[model samples]
Target: MASLLPYGDVDFSLRAMAGRAEGFGRNAIGGLHGPLYFVTTLADDGPGSLRAGCRRKEPLWIVFEVSGTIHLSSYLSVSSYKTIDGRGQSIKLTGKGLRLKECEHIIVCNLQFEGGRGHDVDGIQIKPNSRHIWIDRCSLRDYDDGLIDITRQSTDITVSRCYFAQHDKTMLIGADPSHIGDRCIRVTIHHCFFDGTRQRQPRLRFGKVHLYNNYTRNWGIYAVCASVESQIYSQCNIYEAGIKKKTFEFYTEKAADKAEQKSGTIISEGDMFLNGAQPCLQTQHTEGCNMFHPSEYYPIWTMEPPSHSFKDVLQICAGWQSVCRPAEISTNLD
Candidate 1:
């Protein structure tokens, strides 16, 4: 029995009502008959901020419409059907962080999350039993673990068209292998870019993952690390100068076996150059993995901005752009 609060009609700024709403429940902000609780990120031209008081079973719709940045130092958890829409604006969540636990039909879109100099600060964390979650068109930077992490029975989740940079890990799905079978999770990652220059390569363990048309550049380690029993079906993916193509070199033996089961084309060279020199892998143990290189003759293509499948579903249009240098291009590794 969760209460419903529609923010589509309210007009309260998150900055103006920060202290007043701290510890305020649904009855205080929205009143008993209030249809919604509106929260904005603009506060006296300073850092627009909002802090949700401890809540038990309330459904909230929070909108981040601030001009500058917003820091959420405390935990804000909502019930089923709650929505947080950033409207493609720049709203940052810093400090303690946001927790969406046991929530269903949740939507978090078009925002930025910056975890401060704290440890274990995650941009958006989906706790166990949180189902039907949608995180789209968000940009996240500077976190301890990753921009977004889904674990513990979090099923039917969608993370699309997001950009992640300057984090220890980019994106993660499922907890440690010891926690397997405690959750049934399915994740779809599309059209996202991972820049792992600061950290080791990004890893995704456990669950069934569908990774399509993602671009990774300048990462220290591998692109993705799928678990032993995990089913990772990736297609039309591009990885540039990462440690390994799909698995870290340490897990080569296990990753090779998994790559054999889930088949697809992995383009290790730059997308701007896809010529006959490009290597395609049908299995994990195939030789000549390093002989091929991506060419700069391929055409440049742009997909719809917010759609993760835009690159995979859309067709290429114009000529290729020579962005990478020849010497840099020659050093393409899997």
Candidate 2:
């Protein structure tokens, strides 16, 4: 890979491993701990199949030996202490998606999720009470619901270096404004590519979210958003607005401000933009909402922006090539 930054900067690529004591380089280690579970075929066996490796009780590394697409007939339920590795294979999930419900210590990497539709069809649903989760280097698009929904007290999540394209309501951090459990959701989204996505990239609600070093291009409605007691720390991101697009409110504050209305807080610093006439426009809000710093959780995090342009780095590093597919596999085999 080409050098993306200046000589001495905390590598933007390292953002995936920011909070972990052991670094997560490139791929998120989903079930790569105790034992190795090689997915020998591309067959769907409901929750008993390879699609549901994260639901396994024992600690194991779920790896794909077979290279093909697994079209699900139902949602795949994930368990804790699992790593789903799709490297060295062309693994694609379609027609359905994964659900992480109250699970912990999970990682999902190097998979392609396409055309996921039907009910509850988020690419990845991080449900309530989940913790220590890392979702990295995946390709998510064309889902019926939001691509990713981190809701209901889900915390300690890191979503990085993935490619999100051709979608609307792309990523929803919280379930809804009324879901009170969403306040405990702490997530880190960094170095990802949001390309041609329609909206909600992503709509955050009631979470302490750290968003940094992401490259967004041609969003239909807005790039970043906050509502309902959410605290967003946005730093060092690049937005390339769509030409001929009327709205320039790259950063949006959802819901109207009122004296009795609950509000969300967004602290913006060190961001870049192109063709966005109204980037980072601070809107009206109710007072007394608490603001946060990324260092409160990630003490190693810095406010300093990247030394080089993300445009140059993202062209070669973002998406499936650098994030997923460590080795080439036969996509035509499926």
Candidate number achieving the greatest TM-score relative to the actual structure: 2
Quote each prediction's TM-score: 0.61, 0.82
Model 2, residue pairs in steric clash: 30-82, 30-83, 30-84, 30-107, 31-61, 31-82, 31-83, 31-84, 54-79, 55-79
**What C-alpha lDDT do the candidate models reach, one value each?**
0.47, 0.69
Q: Candidate 2 versus the native: TM-score? A: 0.82
**Model 1 lDDT tens row, 105-202:** 66555566676445655677788787766665577788766567777777666565567777767666666655655235666665566655343233
* C-alpha root-mean-square deviation, each candidate: 15.1, 6.5
How close to the true structure is residue 144 of candidate 1, measured as C-alpha lDDT? 67
Clashing pairs counted in every model: 4, 10
Expressed as tens digits, the lDDT of each residue in 169-253 for candidate 2 is 9998877755767778888887788989988777887778887777888888777777777787778887778852422222233
lDDT at residue 327 of model 2 (Cα atoms): 32
